[model samples]
Target: MEPLVEENKKLKEAMNRSEKNIQRAHRERDLVESNARDLEYQKVVLSEHLATVKEQLRSKSEQLATASTQLKDASEQLEKLQKVFEEKKVLDCVEPETAPQPDGRPPRPDIIVKRCKTAWESFKSFNRDVVVTDATHALAVVQSHYPATDLEVIGGGYAKGLSEAKTQRLEDEVEDTAKKLAGDTDLFGETNGSGEA
Candidate 1:
């Protein structure tokens, strides 16, 4: 009976040890699961942050493209304006007397007349809104070489003729008589008719 009782005690101790080991294994499993959940949450947060950063990068890239296009357009317009300025500079440099003429005796009367006519024509060919301003500049070139009387006779006459023609045409149109004209006369006409007989 004493031997049996000792055997039973040893069996109960072994059972308790087994139960402790099982409980420790369960605790370790729970720790591993908790660590896995934390890692998954971190991964999700990092992925969302990456997405936000990528969207910001995409938006910035689009803005840069738009700005680059605007810069290119402005550069082209500046180049065009520069070309126009250069052309005007060349036109301003032309001097009737210094310019080569067919008969070089103080620049023949016909040559001077031709130069004035060409200058007026060139002014008229410019944009209508800027025609007067451009004409004033072109006339300054003439004023530099010729006497004031010559400038008045040429530049003043051209300005007066253009203004009067425009005024007369507007008056004729207001009177409903412009359609009966012989032809569409230019600003400079041989006969100064107000689009009527």
Candidate 2:
């Protein structure tokens, strides 16, 4: 009986240890599952953040591409303007000397003044033409990039502002030219034999 009782006591102790180990395993499994859920949540958040960052980067890249295209267009236009300027310089160097005065005499003051006025007016016209040409080219570029419907959708204020700015610039240029030619005293006072202002 003592031996059986001792054996029974040993069995009970073994059972308690087994129960404790099972409880410990259950707790460890729950902890592992909770940690796994947390890791999943963090992964979701990081993925969302990464997506947002990628979208922003894409947007920036598109903007940069647009800016680069505009810059390239502007550079091309500048080159064209420079070429035109070079041509104008060459034309100036080769400008015909006022018709030799009849009888080899110096040209009359009136004739000289008239030629100067004509030249000045031509210069002003040329400047205006260049501006108009540049504006036209820019408009063409914009039109090429956007549809007619898109252009129509553009704000009226933007178009108005552009025209107003252009007009203002032209007026300023004319004023400057007038001021410069003002020194001639008679340049604007008389017409070049063509009877045109």
Candidate 3:
């Protein structure tokens, strides 16, 4: 009877160890399943994002191509106009004395202003609805008014709705905020006199 009781005690101990191992295996399996579910969710989200980005990229590429073509056409028109203007500007080539010509003196400020106004009017007459052409003409006028000067242009691009512009602005603001958070402003430079954060 004593020997049988000792054998029973050993059997109980083995059973207890087996139960613990089963519980441990179940926990491991549950953990693996949870990780797999999370990975699947992430994959779905990433695939959706990729599709959206590809569509946007395609649209932007088309827009850029169109803008490039418009710029090329505008440049060609400008060149042709310049040729015609120079040809018409020259007086009679036969006699130097009788040649009616512009005085070689430098143009005054008022004269430059008048030329700019005339150019603006011509561009408007050509196509006021065409924004790229309009902007190019405006820039040309500015450059003609300030010859031999490098100018800075800002906030000029595709004609878009206010909502799209606002969305882009918000995205830019978010990007800027992220960069500010990651970087030290002191390392780059100081703030303006306006005391903005």
Candidate 4:
């Protein structure tokens, strides 16, 4: 009976040790699972961050491409304007002596004033000539003594002559004004004669 009791006590001790080992294993498994969950959450956050960064990079790249294209276009336009300026310079040097010589450089204020004065004088001369011719024709028609029909014919001739002279003067003035304005544009750094601001 004493041996049986000692053997039973030994069995009880072995069962307690087995139960403690099983509990330890369960605790270890739970810790491992918790760590795995934490790692998975971190991976998800990192993935989202990476996606956001990639999107930003793509947007910046597109903007850079657009800016580069605009820069290229501006450079091309500048080249074209430079070419046009060079051609205009050559033409200016070859112009007649009577015209103002801009000399491919900005004209002085005094030179601009002189050119304006010359243009005004030309206009005044043309106007004086027209006035003289009209006066002469009027005097001639008034002095002529003729039959009523002939007088009418003479008056009509005078009217036609005056009208033609006026028209011709107007046309000449318009052409001269255009030429002066074109020169003024070159002196003032404005665009071509088409009047673009």
Winning candidate number (TM-score): 2
How do these models rank on TM-score, best leading? Answer: 2, 3, 4, 1
TM-score for all models, in order of appearance:
0.47, 0.53, 0.48, 0.47
lDDT of every model, 2 decimals: 0.52, 0.55, 0.53, 0.52
lDDT of 4 by residue, 68-174 (tens): 23333334445665565565454344423344446677443445545655665565455445444433433343334211223333323323334656644544534
Model 4 misplacement above 4 A: 99-197
Tens-digit lDDT track of model 2 for 1-197 = 99999999999999999999999999999999999999999999999999999997765443333333333334455677667666656444454456656787875444555576577557656655654454444344445644342432222223333465564554454444333332233334475554445
lDDT, model 2? 0.55
How far in Å is the alpha carbon of 85 misplaced in model 4? Answer: 2.6
Error of 4 at 120 (Å): 22
Clash counts for the predictions, in order? 0, 0, 0, 0
Q: Please estimate how well model 1 matches the true structure, expressed as its whole-model Cα lDDT.
A: 0.52
Tens-digit lDDT track for model 3 on 124-156?
A: 445433444443544454356445323331223
For model 3, give the 10-residue run with minimal summed lDDT.
Answer: 90-99
